[model samples]
Target: MKKLFFLSVLLFGIFSFSQTLSSTLNKTTLALGEPAVLKINIENLQGKDVKSAPKNELLPFHLEETKDEIIKKQNNYTREIEFAVFEEGKFQIPALDFKIGENTYKTIPYEIEVINTAKKGDKISDIMNNKEVKLGLKDYWQLYKFYVLGAIALIALFIIIYYFIRYSKREKNTPKVISNKTLKDLELLKKKKYIENGNYRLFYVELLEITRNFISTQYRIPANVLLTDDLIDFMKQNNTISQENEKVVEDIFLRGDLVKFAKTFPDKETMGADFNDIKDFVKRSSKDIEFENIRSDV
Candidate 1:
C-alpha cells in the first residue's frame, strides 16, 4: 500500500511540471535592421531559474539581449521575458526547458521572419548619370538675412563705444569759475598808486563794482541788485562767508557806504585794508562756487 501511495505522488508532480514552464514570442515579422521584441511569458512555475538556450540548429538570428521580470502570486511564480532579434531570415527561437524538483518541462519552437528595407531618394550610382540645376531668389534671401543681421549688430556696437568716449573727454576738459579772483582783481585796482594820487573816489567806486562781480561768480546771483545789507543777509543765509570773513566783507560795505553817501576820506591804511579784504573774500569763495550757463565774455 505505501509503494502504491509513493507512485501516485510522483505521477502527480510530473503532471504539474508539464502544465507549467511554457513560453511564447509575440510577433514573427520585422523589417531588416529593424528591432523585433519576443515576449516569453512563463506561468505557474515551481522555481524561477531558467536555463540558457542550446547552441544547435535553432536561432539563425543573433540573440541580441534578453530581459526578464518575475512575479509571485499566492502559491506560484510567473516570469515575463523579452528577447531581441537582429539578423535577417526565417529563424526559430529554440525551446527553453527547466526542471522543477524531480520533473521537467519545455517550450515549443517559435518562428519569425525578417524583411528587407526600402530605398530612400535615389541610388547614388543612378544620380551620377544626372545633372545639377540652379537655385532661385527665395533661397538667396534666406542666406542673405543671416549676414545682414550680423553686420547690423557690429555697427550698433561701434556707435555705443564712440559716444561714451566723446562724452568722457568733454567732462574732463571743462573749466571751473574762479569767484575769489574777481574780488581780488577789484582790490588790486584799488591798491594801484593812481587811486591814492588823483582819483580816491573813483577807487572806491571801482572797489564796489569788484565786490558785486565776485558775488555774481560765487553765488550765481546777479550782483547789480545787491546793496551792503543785501550782501550781508545773503552771506548769512547761504553760509557762504565765515564769521571772520563776513566781518571783513561788512567793513568793505561800510567803507563804500561812507565814500558813496557821507563823502568821508579814509587814510591809506584804512583804504588798503578794505582792498585786502576784497582779495581775501574772492580767494576763499571761488573754490566752492560754479558759474552756471556762463559763456566767456572774454
Candidate 2:
C-alpha cells in the first residue's frame, strides 16, 4: 500500500511538471498610445509542438503579436510570446490556450492599466489640477499687429505694381493666330512618317484630329467631339465652309472613319492625297475668314 501511494504521487508530480505556463506584463501602468510588453513563458512541453495562439480579436486587451519563439534545451522546451497594446484602459490579458499532443493547457491572465493624457478644458483641470490661460483677440493682435499690417501692405503693393507692369506689356505682345498654330501642328504630324511606317490607324486618327481641331477653333464649333456624319451635317447647315472645301472635308472624314473603325488600310499615295486635300481646305478657309474680318472692319 505504501509503494502504491508513492507511485501515484510520482505520477502526479511528473504530470504537473510536464506542462507549465505563466504570463507577465513589462509594465503595470502606461500612458495612452504607449506600448507595453506582455510576456508569456511556457516550459516542459514534453516533445509536443504548440499550436498557434488565437487571433487578437479574441483577447480582452487590444494586443498585437511581436517576436515569439519556441526553443529546445536538453530534454525540455521553452516558449516565449510577446504582445503589445496601445489602448487606454484597465484590461486583462485573457488566458491563452495551447495544444500539446492530445491535451490542451492554458496560461494565467494578466492585467494592465493605461492612462489617457488628453482631456477637454474642465476635464484637463480635473485630471492635471492646473489653471488655464485665457487671452483675448486684442491682446494677440497687439503682439503681431505690425506683422499683420506689413503683410497686408506688401500684398496690396504687389498687386498694384503687377497690374502696372502687365498693362505696359500687353500692347507689345501679339496674340497667337489659330490658323498659324494649325498649320504648324499639321507640318509636325507629317514628319512623324506614320504612313511609311504602316501605322495607318494612327495616321488616320491624327489626321482627323488635326482637321477637327482646326474647324473647331476657327468656327467656334464643337467639331472635335462630333461624329463624322454629325459634323458634316452641322457644317452644311451653318454654311460656314465653302461647298468645295465641304466635299473635301466629307471625303477625309469618311476615309478616316473606315481606317480607324473598320481597320481598312489605304495606300501611301491615297494618304498623301488626303493630306494635300486637308492643306487645301485650310488655305481656302483661312482666306475666306480673312476676307470676312476685313469686311467687318470696314
Candidate 2 regions exceeding 4 Å error are: 1-176, 291-298
TM-score of each: 0.37, 0.40
In candidate 2, what are the lDDT values of residues 1-298, reduced to their tens digit?
9999999999999977676766666787777656666555556766676664543433543655564666655445555555555776787776777676667877777777878766656442355657788889998999899999999999999999999899767634312366667778889989999877878888889999998988887776789899999999998997767789889999989989999986677999999999888987876776656655676699
Stretches off by above 4 angstroms in model 1 are 1-176, 180-184, 187-192, 287-298
lDDT of 1 by residue, 1-298 (tens): 9999999999998786643555656677877655555444445554555444442312444755455555555336455555555666787776666555455666677777876666677555664666786778887879798898889999999998999899777555332234535645764685577446855577778887877776665565555787788878887776655567678777887778887775788777777777777776666663333322232332
User: Which candidate number would show the highest lDDT if scored against the true structure?
Assistant: 2
lDDT of 2: 0.76
